[model samples]
Target: MDLNSSSPQTIPVVSTFSSPFDQSPPVKDPNSASTRKPISLWPGMYHSPVTTALWEARSKIFEGLLDPPKDAPPQSELLTKTPSQSRTTILYNFSSDYILREQYRDPWNEVRIGKLLEDLDALAGTISVKHCSDDDSTTRPLLLVTASVDKIVLKKPISVDIDLKIVGAVIWVGRSSIEIQLDVIQPAKEESDDSEPVALTANFIFVARDSKTGKAAPVNRLSPETELEKFLFEEAEGRSNLRKRKRVGDRKEFENGEVNQLEALLAEGRIFCDMPALADRDSILLKDTCLENSLICQPQQRNIHGRIFGGFLMHRAFELAFSTAYTFAGLVPCFLEVDHVDFLRPVDVGDFLRFKSCVLYTELENPDQPLINVEVAAHVTRPEIRSSEVSNTFYFTFTLRPEAKATRNGFKIRKVVPATEEEARRILDRMDADA
Candidate 1:
């Protein structure tokens, strides 16, 4: 379905071949006698040199080995850029028998959502870099780090046999933060004028930091032009305010020991589950349904920014979450959405990272499709300092396919019961956030 088409005031419809921003550069013909090999032909080719330079500069500055360029433009010279100025469209022509397509295909012959997540993160970063740049290649670039993913919803399953387009642009910008909106679209067959069906939508939040001082850096302001642009800008503003208010509310709620009606009801349910005679046999303790994996952060997995790649962390977390759901339900679970992801801290190389996942809750309201909510927490542990910090938290929603459910005859997911107050609080927090 065309979500943007539903509203008259929505952003201008994106065309299949034309866009506000520059189109994808033409693919170089391999047969052409060129002294240089195309980056695509190389396995480990880094696509964006501008982004890589910025990341490397940031790392050097952090380590006190280099200083920010003296010729960097002053804040007064930063120009206000419109969303269209940085709007970008990247196409993945998987319909062709290309080598890259094979890497993104899953065992089911569908696009691997995990790999797509990684590409999305990379694309968002690229857009942010474009928005921050003043069209001057000589000046040093600001370090933009992914602060969090506001939301990512998959409206339709993606097929690997079709070409996919990723369109994104800066929707809003704060003094030191930027919000980017991205849409994953599948071009309509026959190339008609109809809007493409959006398979997914994601909003990513990034924070700008100075390469020299490692301090919050100012970014170009966003100037909304069309009615749709203005509306999206306002919507993003509201979401930002809501996030702030929610954070404050959470802190106060924890400090005051407040218990709402929903929390009280859930607490009662926990109490009931504690009683063997009254407990539901179809329920399982949340703690008892956990799966975990550990790995040392390696340099090879780092991003262009020289730290552990956010997408890599997401890929690992997602695999674990998927496995946890599969093991719990005894059926292959289909990913529904990434409710949200929070990057709490930067994970340095060589840090021992542990990914812990568990089934947070389940919804059996729809008999045909049982939904499972899984949460994965990425912790960076330093045994020498006896410190363990949560670097990232991911929430994924999955559901059983109808065919898989039908094959099981009477498959049912057990309700996840919180065994401790902490677990109960975690569930309540998630529920509250969703609400």
Candidate 2:
């Protein structure tokens, strides 16, 4: 269903309870929070039985967004393609109870950034599927998976019970890749207020795959008619080029002599070039700042593919980064941006995922305005095979809150001292060339 023609007033919100399989309950109060359903998700299209049931249970409300509006004018045709094939937007207003969940409901009834990441991933997936489905004529929709979260900026913390709007649009398209931009919006409290506050903005890249071959599939080419759309298309194109270059460089370094060089350096007990000296370690490096978190992927966190959710993994990494940053700066660190996240492999339900995070680099030219760079690596250990594989790597940047910066005195940014030459090379490779 195309939402380009939908009207806000006539659309009935999600009425089904939060569970995946439960039927819609009778409304006692028309204006209650339970009655104001969140956005509807696509129910039955692909994936396993349990996954389908879960999606169906969670997706009943998303269809309401396609309902026609009662107060707005006709759908504009200037920005996108035809109403049926054009871009779409979904509006969701999750309640505090729904967001806080059972475990997080105790003292702090705040929404977790992990939950927001889950929603962001889902939103981007939905947009990619819809964009690809425009030209698909088969019964099965085109399958697409998230390749990477190129960049994301969380401007402010999202609280529980607030009405948040997620806007998704296709900015650029490649032969099999699509770049999606998502904006997390916080509507103004006062009706008279004209400002629409954006809490977060993200750029996600997805790859289309052939159903039978499981290989890259061609997608529809995007035509940007508007100037803003054209600009985003160019930007996405450039980012895509950079991504390709980095991947090629990494592959070459790993295949060539870089890995061996690092290993040899480690064996020789020599330090890497352009690194801080061992004598300065006491003053620059903090002793207890690094952190590690471990957890088994439960059934609840599994997505339609019976694999652990990417957003859940990202959330775990983010929490680790935040904690490490807080420990280093002795302040309430605010989320600045996610520089990059590469999903190396899918984590299974029973896999033991370990998140190792440390403050990789810090810039403290001005104590009041401190910046931190953290690197979080995810490794999954399979119990059956007694083996572990690298799963994901996340690079994050954060800043301390203004009030904390103002009152702090002894806080300092610590530099990571690589324990080995391989570790040093990893640190060097992790640095963003663009930065």
Candidate 3:
């Protein structure tokens, strides 16, 4: 069946009621399948049986890593796969009777969106591996790593009491890159005629690399059968093009010393520096709102390929961004959307990782719900060499809690002002991207 057919395809939903870590003790018989322990899935609100099976099947990649084969098949021998072939669904039963609701509920009785982001990354990885896997499992598996997250938009607030499901599949594929699209949906209640509403949509891009050589590896071509599938493929292609154009434009702008609206902002910044007392009392300097955290990556946080997991980085970055927004807004901050995330370099297990976050800007167009943009840059520090390199950059948007405006009298967020030329340039760059 076509994944994007007009009629909804029947997806095999795997419930998250049983904990993957709660399996029974291994049997005495060596030949019995129960004697073998199942590959443990990451602890989370949702888990797909299909993904688990895939992981178990590909577990031999670890052995191959130690002793790699001499010859490998060429890219031309790979099979062409359809979107439906890699489609998967994971169900989160958060109804009134289910015990799983407590795990996902926040203090405000709403679903925790940060945890969901982590799971989305995991699910996207599963889809990518499923699309790139071949029939011959004896050979080594490709090392699929997350290249970037194009965008994740929140369409509606997710309630903790409703049943939810996440469906995802490969929407487009290139020479060595694959784009996966995921939809988080709230299923309709029993006896209701309403349709399932999508609460969030996410697009993730993954790149395949040879396990032994650590070079680019080819992936199966995606064949879109239905009109919807074709349209999505084309849309992803256009987004890829836009990203390339943006990079080129940014380089040219910097080379030509073009600062369109930044000149005025620079002048304003200089004036603020010259006369500190004349600045607006209701505003705060962007530099003063920074928060930083540092830690050494551990083996427990590594992914299947023995590298730091991308989801772990995202989870930590998001927590810091939330804290930055909360401090800047002086109230509880709610996650609005993840604008974009770029994985520039892979972080190692023992790398000293530092996460620095600050409030980049704020939008007060809506007085009741002020929007705040937070940026987090992850850097790997090497004290021996006295050098540091950025491994990832994350951009997140947040807002104040809805009740904050009603509870606090004359409540307003202080405007964030840039005091340095670099800060001014950052603000202008964000504005141009939004435009």
Candidate 4:
């Protein structure tokens, strides 16, 4: 499987058929009157499923991001690690010192002043971050606070933006709701005189979305997210989530590769077959007619950094499987899981690779969408001569998802088949119940 000596070519085998892919919508024109038109999403796409899976996996992805156990210890004497050192803490700062001013209300001139003082005391107790602080003062934890959209964004940049003027800001806990806080950090420098050199501080709370249809709008604070705030800013780490790494294998030589050339790689393909009978079949393929030029590869691809990158070959295999599945299903396919990968040989960057997919099973759980099971595989395509070495293989599950009409009940899977009978049999069964 090491691909050091020869060039490579990619072949796309599928047994399926499909209508032309509908193009994505054009970008909105700023000056056009049509700007008010509702934005429409692609009828069927795989991104939603991917997002759902990723969100579910968020905890594992960030497990190493922060120090654990935010709850108070039974006794203060038992503590060893500091609470403020956890990675999840966020910071907040406030500059305005105006007291909860109901002081100037018209009716509050004489007798009304006492009533106003009582009302103000009640308000402060209700709106302050005291709930986030330890009631017994037995435990002291770290605190990161934020209020206002700009503060958090300027501190930590995510992919999108939220309007601070309308919504404010907060620190997000794993799967939990976002919590807002109030806090300050003083400058490191000190003044030469006897006076204190600390700077002034300011903080604000976020406005909640009224309903799904309503955007957030800023308002005077009547309630603050205190309990959740303590968990996020005081109990968590001040750093970002950590990442994982993958290791690679050594490369092999590919001699006199013909199919490995870039000109021969397959683009995509389609065919026709029954919706049932896919699970038992082996070695699935695509209908050649729908495919274009075969993919090509050079010898340099085989010996990648002395060892080939197994991950890249996995991608190549997935591309072929998805393309073939898309043709048969007639819609975008979602990769639900990559159950396992067996790397029998190293794959260089230049080694041409071929791919195939077969339908495992499918059935209608609901009338508007069809659930299908697909299997994918990859192989080395260059250096035509053979030795004891075998082609590498991988396995993945895919759902050829459809855009169900709002009122429709179930989906109808399209007919797509590979050239061979055995391959066709494995990819036709449209059966399996929803989880």
Candidate 5:
């Protein structure tokens, strides 16, 4: 069971690993020399021609998302164009490079939410390849990815030679998705601090593909021009119609007396915030509030189409849900949003994964912020029959740092209970179907 164990914990050998819902007989790892290959949908977005001539030598940093019409655009709207000749805003900045600030320093140099989700997944794949090459800046080059990330708050703690910036734009476009919006600012570290907040914001989505049939293609269309880009194009068209009503079943599934109405609202103490009468039910038991990690899926953590890289499994489930919400809220949480992640399968290259995390609920929202949701999951092992598999499932959200008598008034944390009653009606049907 030594699938190249790099140790972050690792223990599941469960007999000899192999069942993420069986592909029937495929677990032989005589110390795997990496050959289980078959699921690598080539997303090598560009493995050099000097990285496609340094992306056509940054065609003017994608002329603000392709304003390319100095003539030629007519073979029947050549893959549809408009949105004022393709939306805009892209800005970047980044500074602190010395092998990226010594690989995210730790003897105190800051910058590590797993190197800020691998630099916000390479700045949301360079704003989805400059908004899918501003709708074909002369064709052939799509292969985008990261098809889901709708949230990523972070709001502070970047340090290490500061700079950053980022920005991005494309609000929502669909017909092969796009979304974008990200933010990530930095600046004001004090020129007598004239405000510049927003240490991160995120909303990504990206899809495009088809660089020789990986499929889904077409893009370009977010027109909105101010009034805050039409209120972020109507909040990215209501989160792209709530991600097409949770992808087509038009949403609605939490029944079975939704955890008997969350155990009659936690046996009548009617929880909805202000809790601390030493919040009970054996102190929020989901197996006594969890947090795990394990490891062994390296190869420099795969990706560029080799799997296991959704921002390095979202930086190992946001550093184990910020170490189980900093050991159940003794403070230091921050990073809010990533309210969903569903990769669901693909973590191979010597699998062993694991992750786990917990605390599935907590809120206060104001009264000195408090939120915390977490969840995590992942799994993989399979050791013959000791079983494992699940693969992925994230759902983050945090917020704590308030200080002054520890967050002024609301947060004696510790609340996620669900340990059956169908995991308490699937955590009250996923927090009432995700709020």
Candidate 6:
């Protein structure tokens, strides 16, 4: 092979380009160093923490529930408050999700109202408050009496549905009165009819983080849903399209009829609603109660140079476990014990950690008790992705007591088989080992 091109006979030498007298290579354009292209940037506005949370709940409910978009709440109910000043702010703060118009409407087709009351039954003890107002001012000292939406008005003209997240709330507070103002985008209708289309308004209820303490208070009801509630179909009997037993008592015709009910039920390949699209009151899927927990830090949680706090991470991990256990057990599931919370390595802030739990085993340890066993896990992504080290794991055991057992009986149970992947198989293996 002539692969030895460097051999003296095959190669040629150029003396002109020799070292000593070699002039420097010509300079390339400094600014035109390389081909230029426009920088790519994600478009549109960025959502604030509040907007993110608001949209999270909104998207969650709408994804798989019947939530109406045209009803409005009554104003009288919107202004209602709890006797306690602490709850007043919480309830008022959570009462709006901006406004949701009809799919093809604007400004006023529906309104959203809310009550965090469903979850508040548990947080009374944790939330510090005092009853200052008289009974005449409002109804009770605890539960909020406000409606989710405060108004609604439908017009002959229609437009697109408007959904905006409510964030950055300012509660105008007095001794007994509080007016909460939330950041929202109010959509306007194109054509203004003399009838004045003004129905769609809405709100959201959430656990407000106390500004001074930075702690989330007990459950508080806010957001008036009267607007949407009024529009929901309360009675579907006569309103449904279920066939009305045509040609009753015709024996000869009945033989040939064979009751085309099945045929009527099966049209156009899609499952038809027997009635107009109806909203279910339970479709607003905000959790009624969340477990008591916080973020913590410790030695094993140290990230870089032992600068990370493990207690802080543990607090968050506990919260994840608590939330999982609470959602599944519902009501007030006790945080009995956090077992073998191994702090393998230091964890620092900014490392994304995931805490999860599922009903591993529910055994009636006693004839009169529902001693449920929850398998909890808290793990962090490899903090130093380059190092491939310092991942943390935390585990726990939670108990569902009788007082709140009734409430959590309906926590969602996932329906899936074991995964076939290596990591998934490891999880399965770990679970089996624990078993």
For lDDT, the strongest prediction is: 3
Worst 10 residues of 4 by lDDT: 158-167
Return whichever of 3 and 6 wins on lDDT.
3
Once fitted onto the true fold, the runs of candidate 1 whose alpha carbons sit more than 4 angstroms away are 1-75, 188-195, 254-278
Clashing pairs in 3: none
**Which consecutive 10 residues in model 1 have the weakest lDDT in total?**
6-15
Q: Candidate 3 residues 1-435, lDDT tens each?
A: 112222232233233677454574532435333233334633221233433433444433333333345675434467899999888776665663355677677888877777778778878887787788775535667888999999999887788887677889999998999999999887444524256778899999999998768899988899999999999999999998888898778857864675656676666556568888887778788888899999999876776777787878898999899999988878889888887678999998899999999998888998867899999999999999999999998889998777765677887887777888789878877766665
- For candidate 6, the TM-score is 0.26
Tens-place lDDT per residue, model 2, 1-435, is 222224422111232235432345443434333443322233223232222332343342323222223342321221223212435445443443353243222224444665567667766776666566543121233457788899898876665555455666888988888888988766544433345677889998888775445677777667887788888889889999988887678757655756655564344233323443634443333223578989987876765445677777887898899888887777788778898777778788888989988777667677666778888889998778889888998988888866676786776665455555556566556653425
lDDT of 1 by residue, 1-435 (tens): 332332211222122322222333444436433232222232221333222322332322222112334766544477899999777666665665356567678877778888778767877876787788765434566888899999998887788877777778899999899999999998555554356888999999999987657899899999999999999999999999988897768867864674664465366457556666777778888877899999998766775566877877888898999899999999988998897677899998899999999999888888777889999999999999999999999999999866677787767799887766677778877876776
The residue-level lDDT of candidate 3 at 378 comes to: 99
Error of 1 at 204 (Å): 0.3
Candidate 2's C-alpha runs over 4 A off are: 1-21, 24-86, 92-111, 134-138, 156-162, 187-192, 250-278, 281-288
Q: After superposition, which runs of candidate 4 have C-alpha atoms over 4 Å from their true positions? A: 1-305, 365-369, 383-390, 400-411, 414-435
User: Which structure is stronger by TM-score: 4 or 5?
Assistant: 5
Give the least accurate 10-residue stretch of model 3, judged by summed lDDT. Answer: 1-10
Q: List residue ranges in candidate 3 displaced over 4 A.
A: 1-37, 41-76, 96-99, 188-194, 254-260
Candidate 5, pairs of clashing residues: 16-383, 17-382, 17-383, 18-382, 48-51
- lDDT (Cα atoms) of all candidates against the true structure: 0.74, 0.62, 0.76, 0.30, 0.58, 0.30
Q: How far is candidate 4 from the true structure (C-alpha RMSD, Å)?
A: 27.3
Cα-lDDT of candidate 6: 0.30
Report the Cα lDDT for candidate 2.
0.62
Best by TM-score: 3
